[model samples]
Target chain A: MDLFEHQGKELFARYGLPVPSGEVALSPEEAVAAASRLGLPVVVKAQVHTGGRGKAGGVKLAADLDAVRGHASDILGLDISGHIVRRLWIEQASDIAEEYYASFTLDRSARKHLGMLSAEGGVEIETVAAENPDAISKVLVDPAEGLTEEAARAWVEGANLNPAATDQAVEILRKLYVAYTEGDADLVEINPLILTPEGRVHVLDAKVTLDANAVFRHEDYAQYDETQPRDEREEAAHAKGLQYVGLAGSVGVIANGAGLAMSTVDVVNQVGGKPANFLDIGGGANAQVMANALEVINNDPDVRAIFINIFGGITRGEEVANGIIGALEAVDIEAPIVLRLDGTNAAEGREILAPHLNEKLVMEPTMLDAARRAVAMAAA
Target chain B: MSIFVNKDTKVVYQGLTGSQGRYYGMLNRDYGTNVVAGTNPRKAGTDVEGVPVFANCTEAVAATGANASCIFIPAPGVFAAVMDAAEAGIEFVACITEGVPAHDEARFFNMLKRDHPGVRLLGPNCPGIITPGECNIGITAGHIAKPGGPVGIVSRSGTLTYQALYELQQKDIGVTTCVGIGGDPVPGTSFIDCLEAFEADPDTKAVMMIGEIGGSAEEEAAAFIKDNMSKPVSSYIAGVTAPPGKKMGHAGAIVSGGKGTAAAKMDALRDAGVRVGLNPTEAGELMAEIVAEL
Candidate 1:
C-alpha cells in the first residue's frame, strides 16, 4: 500500500526520523487553520499517491493564511496523473543549504535490501541515474545483517554528502532503515533530504510503499488501507475478497490464476475486444468464490460478455465446472459466459457442463477460441 | 535424469498434518516419488495415512534419510519452516505457500546463500517442481504431465505452468522437469537457475520458459541463454496488455518505472535467439517444433 505524504511522515516520526512539523488538512478552512498554527511561510502540498505533484501545480508555498486557503482549495480538487488531491499536507518550510536523496528498497536480483544515497536530490532520481549514474552511491545490505551505523556512515560519505550534515544524515539513514524493515515497507524513500542552514538534516519529502502481505503483522495498517484509491467496482470487488482490477473493456474476465487471468485479458484484447476487469479466483474454484466473482462482474453494466478460463492444477476441472454452474444459479448474470476448461478431470467437467450448454452458456475447446467467441459475443 | 528431482529424491513434508500437506504428500507418493517422512512437533509419533511423522525437520531427515523437503506451511510459518529445512541439511527445498512477506523471503534466501551454500530453494509461493512421472511435488496436476525426456519447463506463474504442461500434453510431448519459480518480488529460484540446470542435464534437450512482467529475471535469463545455453529455447511472456503500475493479480506482475514490460522481455528473449511465442498455445507449439527437430 502506498502512503500519502502526511501518512509517510507520521510513520517516519514513529521511528524517530526528523520530519518537518506538519498538519493534515482535509478542507480549505482546515488548511488555513493548519497554516495559522504552524506559523507563516508554510508549504501546502497536495496529498495524492502519484508523482510530479509540483509540476501539476498541486504544491505551492503559501506565505500567509489567504495564500494557504487559495492553494489548498486549488489543489484539493486538482488531478495529478488521474489521482485527485483530497487531503493537504501543510508544513513549515525548511531552509535548505543542500539537498540529497536516500532510500531503502529490495534489490530483488541480489535478494537484499538496497540503500541508495545521492547528493543530488530534489529531482527525479531516474533522470539522475540515467544522466550521472556515479552520483548515486548504492549499498546492498543483507536483511539478516541489517544496516549498521558504520555502514550508514560509509554510505553517507560515499554519496559525497555535505560534511556538515554527515552526523545527522547518518542518524536519519539508520532510522529510515529501521522504518523500512520494522515497518514492513517495500520502499522507504526521502527525496530532498535537506540540510538546513542551521546544519541540521531533515526529511523534506517521503515516499513509502508498505508491503500488503505484511499487514497481517501490523493491525494499524488498516488506516493506510482506507486511503487507497479505488472505484466503485474495485471497492465492491475488494469487499468480496476478490483480486480485481477495473478496466475499460466490455469483456469480463475470470480465471483461476493471476497469470492466466492476465493472459485472458490479453487474449480478449488480442481478439479485438477490451476486458472490463481482471479477476483471479486464485486456487479455489468452489461455489462461493465463483459466485462472488460472477456477482461482482454481473454488477458492472459495461460488461457485455464474460470469459471464464480455468486450467485446474490442484483444483480439478469437474470442480470448476460445478462452481461455474453453481455461480450461474446463485447470481442473476446478464452477460453471456464463454468458458474454456482444461487440465485435470477436464473431460468430466465438460461432460457435466454439456447438459447446460446454450446461447447464454457456451464452451470452447481452446483459450484462444473462447476468447474469440467472447469478443464476438461482446461485439454483437 | 531430471534436473532437481528424480526417483531417488526422498521427500519430507513440513506441515504434514495440514490438509494441503496431506493431499499433495499422498499425491506425490502415489506418483512414485519416495515420500519418506513428515514433520509436526505435535504428531511426531503419529502418521498421515502411512507417511511417518517426526517432531521436526532434523528428526525427520535423521530418521527417514530425507534430503528434500516440500513445504506446505502457512505463510506466517513459512520462513521458519524453510530455515528448519535448511538447518536439517535438506539440499533441495520447495515451498508451496503463498503470501510470505518479502522481508522474510529476503532474509531466509540470503541466509541460505551464505550459511547453507549447498541448499537450493525453489519457491515460497509456487506450484513446486515435477520431474514429470518420476517425482511430483507441490500442486501441479500429475496426470496432465507426460513423463519422458528432451523437454524442460520453467515458469513464474502457477496456472500458466499447468497450461504449458497441458499444451505439451496435447502434442504428445514429454517433459524432463517442470519448475515454477513463482510470481513474487523475491523468489528463491530464478529463470536462469532452472535454465542452467536444464542446460547441464543430459536428459533435457530443449527449454520452454513462461514469464510475465515483473523483475529482470527473464531479461537476465535471456542473457544467460545468449551467452551460455546451447539448447534451443521457446518463450512466452504474459501481461502484454497489462497497464503500467497495476499489479496484475501476481504481486510481482506489475510494470513499474517503464521497466519489466512484456515487450522488453520478449525483445530480450528474441534477441537471444529464443523462439518467442505470442501466447501460451503458440509457445507450446514452438516448443513442439524444437522437440520435433531434436
Candidate 2:
C-alpha cells in the first residue's frame, strides 16, 4: 500500500505535476551512474516507507559523482525505522526560490477529504499545525463534487501564495488531487513543493500511500518488493493464505474474526499474559487455516502456550474443534492450548476435542477460566 | 425498546442465494426476526428459509414491504448493495461485509446524505445489532444475549463484547440491546451514534462501551457523554498503552500523533464523568458500581 518515493513521483509526473527528474537505482554503481548522468549535483535518497528520512541522514545531496556513490553505498542496506533501504531514488537537485508544502488526506471529523497548503514547507506538518496553525491553509473537499480547479485556486490563494505562483500552485494541487482520488490513495504528499531559481515549481518529494482494500480494483498495484524477508511466523502464516500479524510475547492466539483477534490480544495482556501473535483464520475454522495458524505459532520459540477462543456463530464450533485437532496432528506443537468454544454445536465441539484433554490441550467452559488457565500455563 | 431492530422490524437479506445468506437468514428467522424478503441478482423467485428472494433490493422491498435490510454482498459489490438499499427505502440497513474500500465508503456516506437522508446504516464491517429478546441480525452470539431491562452495550470489538457480556452474564446482568460497531476505519455508525440511541431508550439505564486503540470515535463518544447523557456510562478501552504495531488494527485502528490511544480515550471518558475501567474484566463491575453510585 505504501509507494516508494520514486513510484509516487512517477504518478505525480503522469498527472502533469512538476517533479524533479528522478531515477531509481538498486546498486551503488547504478546510483553513481545516475548521478553522473544527471550531472553532479543530485540528491541520493534511501527509499524507505517512513518519513523524516532527512533527519535520519537517509537523504543527502551529492556534490560529486564519487560522493553520490559513497552516500549510496552507505545508505543501501541501512535501516531506517526498521525498514531496510534496498533502493535509492536519485533526483536532479533543485535550487529553491521558495519552499512550500502541500498534501491532501482524508479528514475523519469533517467526513470529507481535506487539503492543506502551507507557506512553510520541508517541515513536519504536525509541527506547523502546532506552532503556527494560521500559516497552514486548509479546505474540505466534498466527496460528490471532488476537488475542483476553482476550489484548488481558492486554497492556493488562501495559502497567501503570490499571484504568479498561485495559478501554477492551483494547477499542481488540482492534478495532485486527481492523483489522490483516481489513484485510490489515502495520502498524497508533495513535501517542499519548490519554486526553482528558473521560476518553475516542482515537487521535490512524493509520499503517496494507497488504500490496501482498494488494491483489488487495481490488480497492478499489488506488485511489491517480495525480496525483503518478513518475520518467520508471518511468512509461514501468509504461505498458508492466512492474515497473520506477529507480536512480541508468549501466548499464541487463534481467533476467528479480525475484531476477535484484536480483542484476544487485549484480553491476553489484561490477564497478565503477553501475546505472541494475532492470527485470524478469518471466520473459517477449517483444518487448513487452523493448521496454518498452528504451524506459524509452532515455529515461534517465544510462544509458550496457545489460546483457541471461538464464539462460533456463522462458523460452526465442531468445525473449529476439528481444525484444532487437525493442527495438533499436523504439527509437533509442544505448547499448552487452552480453548473455549461456545454457541451452535458447542457440545459436539467439546466432544470432538475431548480426546486431547491433556495438560497441554485443555478445554474449559468459560472464556475467563480459559484465559486464566492459558496465562498460568504459559507462565509455567 | 431497542435502538434499531425489534420483533416488528421487517428485514431483507441481500445476497440471499449465497451460502452465508442462506445460513444467517435462516438463523435470524429462527431468532424471531421477520425476515420478509431477500435479494440475489441471479436467484429471483427462489425462497430462502421461506422468505421471498427477488432480483434486487427495490423488487424485494416492493414484494415484501421490507423496512430493514441485512447485507451479505462481497466487498466488490457492497457499494451498489448499499446504494440499492438506500434507494429501496430501507430505513435501517445492517452491512456485515468487511473490507469495503475507504473511497467507496466516502461515496456511500455522501450518497446517503444527498439521496437517502432518512436511512441509518449499522456497519460495513460491524457484527450488526441484537435487540435482546426481540431479534438478532448481526454475527454476535444470540444465546449469550438475553432480553432484559436496563443495560445497553456498545462495542468496537465483537469478541471483547462477547467476553464482557459473558462476565456480565455471570453477575446476572442482561442487556436491552448489544451493538458491535466494528473496528473498520470508516464504520457506518460510531460510538457516539450508539450512545445517542441508548440515551433515548427508556428501558436502558447503564451503558457499557468497549473500545480499542485507534480512531477518535471513543473520544467523540466521551465528549457527547460529557455534554448530554445523565445516565451512568461505564467504558473500557482495549489495548491500554500498547506498543505501536507493525500495522494498525483494521483500517480504523491507528493511533498517530499521540491521539486515540486507550489511555487517551480513558482520560477523555474520565474527564467526561464516565467511569473508565482499568481493564475489561473490571468493566462490568465498574458499570454496576457506577449504576449503584447513580
Candidate 3:
C-alpha cells in the first residue's frame, strides 16, 4: 500500500531518520493551529496518495498563519491526478543548502534490494534517469546481508552528495534501509533530501510503499488501510474479502484468478463491450464467496450483463457450478449472467446447471462465446 | 522427459496432515506420481492413506528417497518449510502457499542461491509443476492435462495455466510439462528458467508463455528466447485494460511508474520473433499452429 508523504515521514521518524517536525491536519482550522505550534514559515503539503502535488498546487509554502489557513483550505479539496486531498501535513520549513535523492526498492530482475542515490533531487528521479543516467548511483544489496554502513558510505560518496552532509546522509541511508526491510516497506524514498545551512541532512519529503501482504505482521498498518481509496462497490467487496476493482463499463466480470480476470476484462472489451468491474473470487468458489461476489457486482447499477468465467484449477468445476447455483438462489441478481465453465469436471458442472439455463442465466461452451454473448446482451 | 519432474520423480508433502496437503498430495499420487512420503512433526510415524509420515523433510527424504517436495504450509511457516526441504537435500521444491512475506521469499531465495545451488525452488505461492500423466506436484487439476508431448507451457497465473492446458487438450495436443511461476514479487522460478528447460528437453517442441503486468521477467524471457532458443514461442500477456496502480488480485500484478505494461511485454516478445496473441484463446491457437508445424 502507498503511504501518503506525511505517513511515510511518520514511519521514517520511527526509524530515527531526521525529518522536519510535522503535524497532520484534516481541516483549515487545524492547519492554522498546527502552523502556530510549529512557528511561522511552514510547508502545507496535501496528503494524497499521488505525486506531482507541488505542480498541481496542492503544496504551498506559508510564511504566516493566515497563509497556512489559506493554503490548507485551497489544497484540502484540490485534486492531484484524480486523488482529492482530504488531509494536510503542516511541517516546519527547512533551509536547503543542497538537495539530494535516495531510495531503496526491489530490483525485480536482480532479485535484490536496489538502492539509488543521486545529487539530483527535488525533481522526478525518472527525469534524472532519462537525462543523465550516470548521475544516479545504483546499488543492489543482498537481502541476506542487508545494506551495511560501509557500503552505504560508499554509495553516499558515489552520488557526489555534499561533503559536509556525507556522514548524516550515510546514517539516514542506513536507517532508511531499516525502514524498508524491518518496516516491510516495498519502497522507502527520500526525494530532495535537504542539507540545511548547519550541515544537517534532513528528509524533506518521503515516499514509502509498504508491502500489503506483510500487513498481518504490523498492527499499525491498519491506519494506512483505513485511508485507502475505494468506491462504494469496492468497499463492499473488500468487506467480503473479494478482490474487486470498479471500472467504467456495463459488463461485470467475475473470474477465478487475477490473470484470468484481467483477460476476461480484455476479452469483453475486445468484443466491443466495456467491463463494469474486475472481480476475482480467488481459489475458492464456495457458496458464500460466489454470493458475495454476485451481490457486489449486482449492486452496480451500470452493469447490464454479468460474465462469470471459471476455469477450475484447484477449484473443481462441480463445486464452482454448485456455488453459482447456490449464489443465484441466495441473491436476487438483476443483470443477466453469461456463464462459461471449463477445466476439471466441467461437463459435470454443465449438467448441474442444465435445469437453470434460461434467458437470464445462459451458459456458453467457450470463453470467447461467453464473452461475445455477454457483450451482445450488454449492448442490447 | 519433462523439465522438472517425470514418472520417476519421488515426491513428499511438507504439510501432509493439513487439509490442503492431504487433498492435493493424494490427488497427485493418484495421478501416478511417486508420492512416497509426507512430513508432519506431530503426526510422524503415522500415515495419510498409504503414504508414510515423517517428522521432517530430512527423515522423509532419507526413508523414502523423495527428491521433490510439494509444500502446503501456511504463509508464516513457508519460509522454514522451504529451508528445511533445501537443507534436507531435496532436488526440487514447489511451495503452494500464498501470501508469504516478500522479505522471507527474498531471503530464502537468495539463501538457496548462495547455499543449495542444486535445488530448484518453483514457488512459495504457485500451483506447482505437472508433467502430464507422469508427476503432479502442487494443486493443478491432473485431468485437464493430456499425457503426450510437443508443447510445454509456463504461466504466471494458476487458473490461466489451466485454461492454456484445456485449450491445447481441445486441439488434441498434449504437453510435456506445465509450470506456474506464481504471481508474486519474488518468484522462486522465472519464465526464462522453464523456457530454457523446455528448449533443452527433446520431448517438448513448442512453448506457450502466459504473463501479466508486473516486473521485467517476461521482457527478459523474451530476450532469452531470441538469443538462446530455436523453438517457436507463443505468448500472451494479460491486464491490457488494468488501470495503473490497481493490484489485480495478485500481489505483484500491478502497473506502476509506467512500467511492466502488457503492451511493452507483447512488443518485446513480438520483436523477438515470437507470436504474441491478443488473448489467451488466441495464444493457445497460436501454440497449436506451432505444434502442428513441428
Candidate 4:
C-alpha cells in the first residue's frame, strides 16, 4: 500500500495541486530526455518506497543535462532500505523561499481524521515533535464537516506560520485534505511544501499510503509490484489461494487464521525457535489445501522443520489430519513436523494421525508442547 | 447482568444476503441468538435461513422490531448500513464487516456521537460479542464458549478469544460475555468502553482484556481503570517487543513510534494496579489470582 514518490506525485497532480512537472524514467537516456523536456535545473530522484533516500545518495539536483544523466545512471540500481531503484523521477527544480510540512492521517484515539502542519519542513517531524513540539500543529478534523477553509486557516495560524504565507497555506491545506480523502489514503505527507521565490506554493515531495482494504474500489490503483523477487515457495502458495509471507530462519508454520499464525510465530520465538514463514490457510481447510501448504514449506530450502497448529471450529480437525497424511504422500519433505489439533472431531483427527506418528510427523496436545518439539527438531 | 447483550435481545442482520452475512447468521442462530430478520437491498422480500429479509435496516427494524443488528455489508456499503441501522433506532449494532475506509468510519463515528448518542456500535472490523449460554452475535467459534458467569472477556483478536476462552473453560472459569473489539485501525468502541462496562456489571466478578500492538487503547484503558474502576482486571497486550514497524496479529497491529506497544501497555497496566499476564494462556490465571485476593 506504500506508494513510491513518483506515484504519489501522480496522485497529487490529479487533484490540481501544483507540483514540479516530472516524468519517471527507467534509463539514463530516458532521464536525459525527461530533463530536456522539463528544461534545465532538474532533480533526479531515485524512486523507492522508503525514506532517507537523500542521505543514501539516491537524490541529486542536476544543473544541466549531463549532470542529470550521470545522477540517473548512478541512481538507477541504487538500493535504499532493501528496495532497489528501478525508476528515476526527473523534475524541474524550483527555487524555494520557504519550506513547510503538512500531512493528513487517522487519529485513532480521537476517533477523527487528523491534520498535522508545521512551518519547518523537509525533515523528520518526530525530531520537531520531540524537541519543539509547539512547531507542529495538530487538528482533529470532523469528517462530517470535512476540512473547510476556515479550519485550514485556523490550523495554519496555530502552526504559527509567517503571516505572509497564511492565506496560501490555507488554500493548499484544503486541496491536500480533498486529495487525501478522495484518494482513499491512510496517510498523505507533503514535506517541504515549498513557497517558491515567485511566491507560489508548490509540493516539493508527496508520500502517500493507500488503505489496502479499500483497494477493491480503486481499480486504477494498480497492485504494488512488491518490487522484489518473491520467495518461490510463497509464490507457489499464493497460486494455491493460501496466504503465505516468508521470513528468515528455519521453522515453517501452518495455521488456520492470521491471529493463530502470528501467535504460532510468537510461541515459536518464545521457545527459542525462529519461524521461517507465516501461513494462513483461512477458514476452510482440507487435504488439498493442506497438501498445498506442506508442499510450499517443503519447497523452501531454509525450512528445517514444520509446525501445523489448528484450533478447529468450523474447520474440522479430521480434515486437517487427512491433509497431513495426504501432504506426506504428495511431497518429499525431509523436515520434522509437530502437529497440534483441537476442537471438533479432534479425537478422530488425532486417531487418524496416530498411524503417521513419527519423529518427523509428531502430534502434541498443547501449543507449548508442539512449539517446544518444533524448536527442538529445528535446532537438531 | 451482561453489558450489551443477553438472552432476550432480538437480533437482525443488515447486508444478510451475502455469503459472510448468511454464514454468521446461521451460526448466530445456532448459538441461541434470536435472529429474527435481515436486510438486503437487492435480495429484499427473500428469506435467508427462514428469517425475513427486508430492503433496509429501517424496514427490517419496523417489521421485526429487532433492536440489535449484526452487519455484514461490504466496505463500500458499510457506511450506509451502519447509518441505516442507527437511524432505524437499533440500540446495539455489531459491524462485523472489515475494510471500511477510515474517512467513512470517521463520518459514521462522528454521526453516531452526535445523532445516535444512546446507541453502542461494537466494531467496523470487530468480531461481535457473545453472552455465553444466552446469545452470540459475532464470528468467534460457538463451540469454544461455554455458558457460565464469573469472567468478563474482551479481546482484540478473534482467534485469541477462542484460545483464551478455551483455556479459561479448562480452569472452570466460565464467561459472562466475550467481546471481540476487532483490531481495525478505526474501531467504534475503545478498550476502555468494554472495560468500563465489565467494571459495572454485577455478575462479572473479574475481567480479562486482550490487546495487541498498534494503538494506545490498552494504555488509555489501563489509565481509566487506575483512576476510576475498582474491579479486578487482568490484561495481556500481544506482540511483546515485536520488531518495530512490522504488524504481528492484526492489520491494525503496527508499532508506530512505539506508542501502542505490548511492553508500553503492560507497563502502564502494571503501574495502574491491574494484573498483567505474560502470555495469552496466563490471562485467566492472573484474573483468578486477582479475584481471589479481592
Candidate 5:
C-alpha cells in the first residue's frame, strides 16, 4: 500500500533516519501554527500518493509564516494526478550543500533487493538512468548478507560522492536497508538525501510502499489502508476479504483468478455490456464466499445482471455448482445470474445445476456466450 | 516427454498434515502422482491417507527415494521448509505457499543457485507443474489436462493456466506440459527457463506463454524466443488496462515506472515474431491456429 508523505516520513523517523522535523496539518491555520512552532522557513508539501508533486504545484517553500499560510491554503485542495490534497506536511526547511538519491526495491530479474545510490538527485531517476547511467551506482544486495557497511561503502564510492559525505552516506544507507527489509516495505526511496553546509545529511523526501501481504504482521498499517481512495463498493469488498475493483456498469463479475477475472470484465465490455465491478474469489468458491460476493454485488443498484465465471483448477466444478446453489439460497440477489462453468468435472457440475436452470439462474457453455447472455439480459 | 515432471518423478509433501497439504497431496496421489511419504517433524510416523509421514525430507527421501517435493506450509515457515528440502538433496522443489517474504525468497533462490546447483525450483506462489495422464504436483486439477504432445504451456496465474489448458482441450489440442512459474515479484523460475525446456523437449511442438503486466519476464522470454526457439510461440498478456500503480492480484502484476505494461510486453513479443493475444480466449484461438498450420 502507498503511504502519504507524512506517513512515510514518520516511518523513516521510526528507523532512526534523519528527517526534517515535520507537522501534519489539515488547515491553513494549523499550517501557520506548525510553522510558528518549527520557527519560520518551512516547506509545505501536499500529502498525496502520486509523484511529480512539485511540478504539479503541490510543494512550496515558505520563507516566513505568511508564505506558509498562503502556500498551505493554495496546496490544500490542489489536485495532483487525480488525488486531491486533503492534508499538508509543514516541515522546517533545511539548507542543501549537495543532493543525492538513495533507494531500495526488489529487482525481479535479479531476484534480489536492489539498492541505488546516485550523487545527482532532486530529479527523476529515470532521466538519470537514461542520460547519465553511470551517475547511479546499482547494488544487488543478497538478502542473506544484506547491505553491510563494507558493501554500502563500496556503493557510495561507486556513486563518486564527495569524500565528506562518504561515511555518513554509508551509515544512512545501512539504516535505510533495515527500514526497507524490517519495515516490510516493497519500495523506499529518498530523493535529495541532502548534505547540509553543517556537515549533516537529512532526508528531504521519502516514498514508501509497504508490501500489502505483510500487513498481517503490522497492525498499525490499517491506518495507512484507511487513506486509500476507494468507493463504497470497493470498501465493502475489501472488508469481506475479496479482491474487487468498482466500475460503472451493469454486469457484476465474479471469477476465480485475477487474470481470468480481468478477462471476464473485458469480455463483458467487448460483448457490449459494462462491468459493474471486478470480483475475484481466488481459488475458493465455497458457499460462504459465493454468498458474500453475491451479497456485495446485489447491493449495487446499477447491477442488472451478474456474470459468474468459474474455471475450476484445484476446486472441483461440482463444488462450484453446489456453492452457487447454496449461495442463491443464502443471498437475496436481485440481478439475473449467468454462469459459465468448465473444467474438472464440469459435466457433473452442469448436471447438478440442471435442476435449477431457469431464466433467473442461467448457465452458458462458454465465456463469450455467458458474457453475451448477461449483456443481453441487462439490456432487456 | 514432459518438461520437469512425469510419472517417474517421486514426490514428497512438506506440511502434509496441514489442511491444504493433506488435501492436495491426496488429490495428487489420486491423480496418479508417485506419492511417497510426507514430512512433519512433530507428526512423524503418523500416516495420513495411507501415505507415510516422516520426520523430514531426509527421512522421506531415504525411505521413498523421492526427488521432487511440494511445500504446502504457511508463509512464515516456507523459507525454512525450502532450505530443509534443499538440504535433504531434493533436486526439484515446487513451493505452493503464497505470501513468502521477498527477502526470504531471495535468500532461498540464491542458496539454490550457489549451493544446491542440482535443485530446480518452480514456484513459491504457483500451481506447480503438470504432465497430462502422468503426474501432477501443486494445485492444478488433473482432470482438466488432456494427455497429448502438441503444445507446451507456461503461465504465471493458476486459474488462468487452467483456462488456457481448457481452451486447448476444447480445440482437441492437448499439451505435453503446463508449467505455472507463479506470480510473485521474484519467482523461483522465469518464462525463459520453461521456454528453454520446452524448446528442448522432443514431444513438445509449439509453446503458449501467458504473462501478466508486471516485470519484464515476457520481454526477456521474447528475446530468448527470437534468438533460440525453433518452434512457434503464442503469447497472452493479462491486464492490458490495469491501472499503472495498483497490483492486479499477483505481487508481480503491478505496472511500475511505465514498464511491465501489457502493451509493452505485447509489442516486444510481436516484434519477436510471436502471436500476441489481447485476452486469454483470443490467445487460445491463436495457439490453435498455429498448431493447425503446423
Candidate 6:
C-alpha cells in the first residue's frame, strides 16, 4: 500500500530519521493554524499518491499566513495526475545547500534489496539512468546481513557526494534503511536527501510503499488502512476478503487466479468489449466465495454481462459449477452470465450445468468462445 | 524423463498432521508416487493415510529413504522447515505455502544457496511441480496432465500453469513435467532454470513459458532462450490490461516505474524468436502447433 507524503514523514520520524517538523492539515483554516504552530514561512504541499506534484502546481512555498491559506486552498482540491488532494502537509521551510537521491527497492534480478544513491537529485531517477548512468551508485543489500555502517559509508563515497556532507548523508541512509526494513516497506525513497545550509542533513520528502503482506506484524498500520480511500464497491469487496479492481466497462470478469483473471479481462477487451472489473476468486473456490463475487459484480450498474472463467486445480470444476448455481440463487444478478469451465472434471461440470444453458445462462467451450459470446451478449 | 519428479522420488509431507497436508498427501500417494513418510513434531509415530509420521525431516528421511519433500507449512514457519528439510539432506523441496514475507524468502533463499549446495527449491508460494502419470507432487491435478509427452511447461502463476496444461491435454499433447516457479519478487527457481532442465530432459521436445507483469524475469528468460535454449518456446504474459502501480492479486504482478509491462515482455520474447501468445488459450494453441510439427 502506498502512503501519502505526510504519512510517510510520520513513519520516518517514528524511525528516527531527520525530517523537518510537519503537521497534516485538512482545510485552509487548519493550514493557517498549522503554519502558525510551526512558526512562519512554511511550505504547503498537496498530499497525493501520484508524482510530479510540484509540476502540477500542488506544491507552493508560503511566506506568511495569508499565502499559506491561499496555497492550501488552491492545492487541497487540485488534481495531480488523476489523484485529487484532500489534505495538505505544512512543513517548516529549510535552507538547502545541496540535494542527493537515495532509495531502497527490491531488485528482482539480484534477489536482494537494492539501494541507489546519486549526488544529482531533485529529478527523476530514470533521467539520471538515461542521461548520465554513472552518476547513480548502487549496492545490493543482503536482507540477512542488512545495511551495515561500513556499507553505508562505502555507498556514500561511491555516489561521489560532497565531502562535507558525507558524515550526515551516511547517517540518514543508515536510519532510512532501518525505516525501510523494520517498517515493512516495499520502497523508501527520498528524492532530495538535502544538506541544509546549516551543515545538517534532512529528508526533504518521503515516499514509502509498505508491504501489505507484512501488515500482520504491525498494528499501527491500522491507521494507514483507515485513511486509504476506496470506492463503495471496492470497500465492500475488501470487507469480504475478495481481490477486486473496479473498471469502467460493460463485462464483469471473475476468474480463478490473478494471472488468469487479468487475462480474462484482456480477452474481454480483445473481443470488442470492455471489462467492468477484475476479480479473482483465488484457489479452492466455494459457494460462499462465489456468492460474494457475484454480489460485488451485481452491485456495478455498468455491467451488461458477466464472464465467469474457472480453471479448477485444487478446486474441482464440478464444485465450481455447483458454486455458481448456488451463488446465482443467493444473489440478485442483473447481467446475463457466461461461464467457461475447464480442467479437473470439467466435462462432468459442463454436464451438470447442461440443463441450465440458454440465452441467460450461456456456457461456451473455450475461453475465446466464452469471451466472444459474452461480448455479444453485452452488446445485445 | 522428467525435470523434477518421477515415480521413484520418495516423498514426505511436512505439515502432514494438518488438514491440507492430509489431503494432498493422500492425493500424491494415490497418484502412484512413492509417498513414503510425513513430518509433524506433535504427531510423530502417528500415521496419516498409512504414511508414517516422523518427528522431523531427519527422522523421516532416515525412516523412509525419502529424497524429496512436499511442504504445506504456513508462511511463518517456512524458513525453518526448508532449513530442516535441507539439513535432513533432502535434495529437492517443493513448498506450496503462500504469502511468505519477501524478507523471509530472500534470507532463506540466500541461506539455501550458500549452506546447501546442489539443493533445489521450487516454491514458497506456488503450486509445486508435476510429472504427469509418473508422479504428481504439487497441486496440479493429475488428470489435467498425462504422461509420455514431448512438451515441458514452466509458469509463474498456478492456475495459469494448470490452464496451459489443460490446453495441452485437450490437444492430446502430453508433457514431460510442469513447474510453477511461484509468484514473488524473488523466487528460488526461475524460467531460465526450468528451461535449462527441460532442454536437458530427453523426453521434452518443446516448452511453454507463462509470465506476468513484474520484474525483468521474462526479459532475462528471453535472453536465455535466445542464447542457450535449442527447444522451441511459446510464451504468454498476463496483465496486459492491468493498471500500472497496482498489485493484481499476485505479489509479483505489478508494473512499477514503467517496467514489467506485458508489451515490454512480449517484445523481448518475440525478439528472441519465441512464439508469443496473446492469451493463455492462444499460447497453448501456438505450442500445440509447434509440437505437432516437431
lDDT of 5 at A256: 84
**TM-scores for all predictions:** 0.97, 0.95, 0.97, 0.94, 0.94, 0.95
Per-residue lDDT tens digits for candidate 3, residues B257-284, read 8889998989999999999888888998
> Which model, 2 or 4, shows the larger DockQ?
4
lDDT of 1 by residue, A1-380 (tens): 89998899999999999999989999999999999999999999999998899999998999989999889989988989999888999999888999999999998878899999999999999999999999999999998899999999898899998899889989999999999998999999999899988899999999999998898899989999999999999999988888999999999999988999998888898879999999998874576777889999999999999999998776677877887888788777899999998876788999999998999999998999999999999999
Best of the two (4, 6) by lDDT: 6
C-alpha lDDT of all candidate models, in order: 0.91, 0.81, 0.90, 0.83, 0.88, 0.88
Per-residue C-alpha lDDT of model 5 across residues A157-181, encoded as one tens digit per residue: 9998878899888988899999999
TM-score of predicted model 1? 0.97
Best by DockQ: 1
lDDT score for candidate 5 against the true structure: 0.88
Winner by DockQ between candidate 5 and candidate 4: 5
Residue A157 accuracy (lDDT) in model 6: 96
Per-residue lDDT over A159-197 for candidate 6, one digit per residue giving the tens place of the 0 to 100 score: 998888999888888899888988888899998889877
Candidate scoring better on lDDT of 1 and 6:
1
In model 3, where do residues sit more than 4 Å from their true spots?
none
CA RMSD per model (angstroms): 1.5, 2.1, 1.5, 2.5, 2.3, 2.0
Off by over 4 Å in 5: A28-37, A62-71, A345-348, B241-244
Which stretches in model 4 have alpha-carbon errors above 4 Å?
Answer: A223-245, A281-295, A312-334, A343-360
Worst 10 residues of 5 chain A by lDDT: A282-291
Candidate 6 RMSD computed on C-alpha atoms after optimal superposition onto the true structure: 2.0
Q: In model 6, what is the error at residue A144, expressed in angstroms?
A: 2.4
Candidate 1 C-alpha lDDT tens digits along B1-294: 899888899999999799889977887888888989999888889999889999889999899999999999888899889999999999999999888889888989889988999999999889999998789988888988999967899999999999999889999999999999999888988998999999999989999999999889899999999999999999999999998988887778989898999999999999999999888999999999998898
Error of 5 at B135 (Å): 0.6
